[model samples]
Target chain A: MSQMEIKNITKKFADVTALDNVTLKLEENKIYGLLGRNGAGKTTLLNLITNRIFPTDGEILVDGESVIENDSALSKLYFMTENNYYPEHMTVKKAFTWTKGFYTDFDIEYASELCEKFSLKLSQKIKTLSTGYTSIFKMILALSCNVPFVLLDEPVLGLDANHRDLFYKELLKNYSEKPKTIIISTHLIEEAAEIIEDVIIIKSGKLILKESVESVLSQGYAITGSISAVDSFTAGKNVLGADTIGGLKSAYILGHLDKSGIPEGLEVTKPDLQKLFIHMTNR
Target chain B: MSQMEIKNITKKFADVTALDNVTLKLEENKIYGLLGRNGAGKTTLLNLITNRIFPTDGEILVDGESVIENDSALSKLYFMTENNYYPEHMTVKKAFTWTKGFYTDFDIEYASELCEKFSLKLSQKIKTLSTGYTSIFKMILALSCNVPFVLLDEPVLGLDANHRDLFYKELLKNYSEKPKTIIISTHLIEEAAEIIEDVIIIKSGKLILKESVESVLSQGYAITGSISAVDSFTAGKNVLGADTIGGLKSAYILGHLDKSGIPEGLEVTKPDLQKLFIHMTNR
Candidate 1:
């Protein structure tokens, strides 16, 4: 098992500071959701970890070894970025062969099976593939690479409803069969909430929250009732936000609910990850 | 007020038929969700309506006037495509000015206001924006175009969870203030379900279902319980799909669920739009 440690990493590009003193530990064999708003430095941090761009300060280590052009450590990692790296004219079949050359552990048979499931023709050129198919091609490679550490950035970018569902199920099945350290960076928070074991939320180039999914979800909830009743009930509580519709109101409050002291018309329910994320990051 | 009428429209590309005798109506001041699998011809239909491409058969009319080569009818419509069309070196402010020339009803003040709300700088060039920002810029244009008929193709494509939440809220607000015929085509069905008044689903270049959101969602539900219990309960019903985890099973069923005589341990809940779309479109 391999663990990645990002320590005090900082990156600046001309006038903007992309990342500032960001540090996090990616444990072995776990599914993590790296979440943030646009330009919040989620991609910057990922690029730093993959050694694509050098950090201005601090360092990244994989299994206690720095990941700065270290071929041995890099070989165990696979990053499926949003941009296509293969030649536009290359056939899907040839791209698979080329990928196998770099990652000797790549499973050709499994890739072919996935292709069949996704209805991707091996003879089709990469450039001719639609947006959805391009995403499928990259996802198939990411899943079949057989690396200890895998990073997927917006893995389901252009996938349709059915294909996205299929991808999630297949991903879970593959993970169960062979446990690996997986970090997924995506904008679809609700779809990924149930699948990710842990979550890391960053805002304005700084890490705001990092915790297990269960605990984070349990930490906050929504209470809805009459406007006056809700306002009085949440007087001293940490309220994130609220919405009013006529005489009714819904207030999102942080902290556990007391079952006995709740008012008659008020209803409390668990907040979904997307709602919580919006409240947390909506500055 | 304006209504879009698609009359037996058919489109072909070389040997492939993109759309096959599809007909639909967009009522004035209503929001419609245009949904389908990839390559199902959702974009083609939108393109045909906007006169971007000629239909091989039939015609499209806006408020009793043909759309083809009709500048007056076309002026009431705006189509926000997936690809960016603005000049690469043009600033966002300049693009806003350019759009006003073509779209006489374009609101420059509203566009600038939305840019501030989304934290998009007016001085930023179109080509230099990130994927999320690019989507935001286009969305701003669509919203401020002030046309009676507006078509948004993947408007929230790369937006984050917070931005997506904001976009939906803003869309609802804008629609409420000045009602228009809005057609949104996207893959995130559940997110758009509440905001969209009606749904139009296409499959393999043919129209499959067109109904109100309430009616479609109420037609199906999911029952979850022990494997044997779920199996016996859903034996004769229309089962869409099933998920099994150990001894427990969850089966998605179509048609109205009978309230009485349900199994003791089985729990019934609503089936989301995405689930219904998958079942409807899956071969």
Candidate 2:
């Protein structure tokens, strides 16, 4: 199994610290969710791992080998972001052919099949595509790269509902067959909550969480009841936030519940991923 | 009361039909969800209403007045799209001041307050902002324009979960305080479903469905049971699709559901909007 280790990495952009003393370990054959607010250094961390930008401190090691100036280690990783570096007039088909020159394992047949599924025209120029189609084109290339570790930042940036559904289903199918390591960075937490096995959260350039989705859900929960009942039950408890509508209220708590200590008319449920994220990241 | 009418509009680009003989009416103090697949002519419809492009057939009117080349009628409408028309060097603060030139009712103080709420720096140039921040800036402008009809095309594009939550909450607050016509075009159906009173779905440059969210949801259902049981239940029904996981199955169906007719060990629920949309638009 392949393993990547980020050890005490810190990145500084001029005087501003984009990442600070962050450490993580990613194992192969697992899908991870990289969750954070804007300017939370998620992109900076990805850049450091790919050696596109050197970290100010510490290092990244893939299979116990330093990734810096190492082409062999870098070749196994593919990072796809929103930025487009291809020529403005390059056709989608031509871009697919060009990608084959760098990545020997690029599957042109699979890409063509994906194009048909997405209803994307192969003859269309990259610059002429809409925002949603632009994301789709980049996603197709990333998926067909056949790399072990694929870093997808906002893969569904501008996709419509139907397209988003198709992409997620296709991704799960690919992972089940290939068993590769994948990390998705996206803002659509509720939609992505199901497929992502583990979540890594950052706040203000510091790692705040690294846990399995199951464990995270088990640790926290939401309680709903009358406003007064919820207030009394949440007294001195680790409350995240609460929403009240007329006589009813729902309070989010970041701790386990004792099932024996129950109140009538109160409902218990799993904590929402997006709600927890907002509560944890808010100042 | 304020109203806008779209009268038998059809837009054609060469031999291809961009929008085909569509008609709809918008009333004041209502929130509408405009939904469609990419290249399905949602943008074309918005452009036609704003008079950025004239329809090949028919016309658009605001309060019974032709919108084509009518500045007085157009002033009541504010369109916020992905495209940036501001000068590259113009900062967010400068853009707010410049908007006052065209919109006499543009609220500079409210725009400044919104910038703070969304954590947007006023001094940042429009060209230098990130994709998420660009959307935020445009949204702030549209909200503060004090217009009767506000059209937002993918306003939450590229925003993080926290920012999206904030934007929706702010939008609701803004609407409650000042009752105006608001149309939101987004792919995040589940998130937007709660706020939008009605949904308008377009497919292949044609309006497929336009109705209240409640009515649309009420008309369809989903049944879940064992594979054999689900198959038997969905047989000869208006089955949209079905999924099989191990021995369990779930089938999505259109038309009214007979709850009492469900077999033992079967569960039924309302249809999912995204699933309904996918089934409607798929070839």
Candidate 3:
């Protein structure tokens, strides 16, 4: 069964149409990447799914049941946003205690272990932690909740490389031990590309692509060669992006090419996630 | 002449040794990635060079002359930090007008162009701008400053993918047209790898590696093959990171490997900058 499904979701904020007829089906036990430019409705869609805000028109289902204000359905999901809205006076320990009441699967021991990994002070008030520490705290809570579905929106905003790596490792380890449906909404596409099983691209409140990682990556190729040769090679092909230096030119084409006919000294390589993202959104 | 130099730099915050006798030289007309773990003194070092804070024991020279409170030396550099502290009532245009007097090379036209590209309103008060817009305002000003050395600390923090791509393209275009030294401190290593000429890796408030980008990437290789063959091949190698799925295993090894005796189903590849960073810093 699908973990979560959004049918023809639409949301409007005054004059802005934040989401327009967006439909998505999130499967079970998979890591999905919800990628889009800022203000592209990724956050709005997430909010709608988590029921932080009601959709203007359409239905959101968690395990085939409407999730809006449904305690049982909401309890099965955990959403960690970019910013924290915890009470200012709540300490880390107190926050966990509160979360334990809401989430039956909350693991105190795991939360403490995560706190140690993040170097968080349990005695310190939630408002007192640094931005990075706050993020780590939220992440720990999200992971320890053990919900069937978890939604993380730009969770690594303030984290450095070491912390990000640790988070990814911990996430994978947790997923392996207890598989769950996870959706990560982020602009850092390349960083999360390897970890995500599926990619969902949103542009101006519309879905662009939703497919497996391998299939998405296989759709484009980067080729470099002499200006004339490169131009000729890309002449009839769908060129996504192009860069030139002196007499050399490189173009990222949106389809495969016959590698054997490439000119000498030219190189053809697979396009990275970042290149593909730029190619798709920059237009 | 070196663009910037630090000799025996030391800084302390109470009992914490933020920087320990660090020394380095930055050449002109190159982009250097100043990367390190959080609180590893990357910001402290940038502060010392820009004269924002005095090092407890150190000497920072710009063109062979001490830059401590020297207007002539300070005028040659510009630092765009993660946060801006503008007056609540200050509009984008007002801030630019005030900044123009401080730098002789400030270009008003270019700044306006950048503001337009970023969709920023010059008449909007600073406090009214979104986090991303505020960053764009500061970045535009920094680029317009036309200093011999420009330092950016997480300049693209809240920016989307499209804006980031635009920023990179504009930065490279500006550099190619005017050739200046640029230092960027960011956690997005792979995204900036292509644009950066040199890299400086710091760990625990100490320099780990300061080398050209080519030299750094050349030191590692990623090998993928059958689980058994990959395991055997990487048995004695310094593995930075490893991942296994089904019968396939990919290992990020620290050094070049002899490919002649490789297994039948194995594939060798170059290590990406992010993987290299995680491997180096996680250790």
Against the native chain B, what TM-score does each candidate's chain B reach? 0.91, 0.93, 0.90
Docking class of 1: high
After superposition, candidate 2 runs with Cα above 4 Å error? A87-89, A223-236, A241-251, A262-269, B224-237, B241-250, B263-267
In candidate 3 chain A, what residue range of length 10 has the lowest lDDT sum? A274-283
lDDT of 1 at A34: 94
Q: How would the candidate models be sorted by DockQ, starting from the highest? A: 1, 2, 3
lDDT of 3 by residue, A170-255 (tens): 99988999899999988788878979999998888888878888887888788898988888777888888887878888888776
- Residue-wise lDDT of candidate 2 within B96-173, one digit each (tens)? 999999999999999999999988999999999888999999999999999999999999988888888889989999
Query: Each model's number of backbone clashes?
Result: 0, 0, 0
Per-residue alpha-carbon lDDT of model 1 for B11-63, expressed as tens digits?
Answer: 99998999999998888999999999998999999999999999999999999
What's the TM-score of each model vs. the native?
0.93, 0.92, 0.89
Q: Alpha carbon lDDT of residue B66, candidate 3?
A: 89
- Note each model's CA RMSD in angstroms: 2.6, 2.7, 3.7
lDDT of 2 by residue, A1-283 (tens): 7889999999999999999999999998999999999989999998888898899998999998899999999998989986898997999999999999999999999999999999999999999998889999999998999998999999998888888988998899889988899999988988889899999999999999999988888878889999999999999999888778789999888877998796988999886788888877876
Assess each prediction's global lDDT (C-alpha) against the native. 0.91, 0.90, 0.86
* First chain TM-score for all predictions: 0.94, 0.92, 0.92
* Cα error of candidate 1 at position B263, Å: 6.1
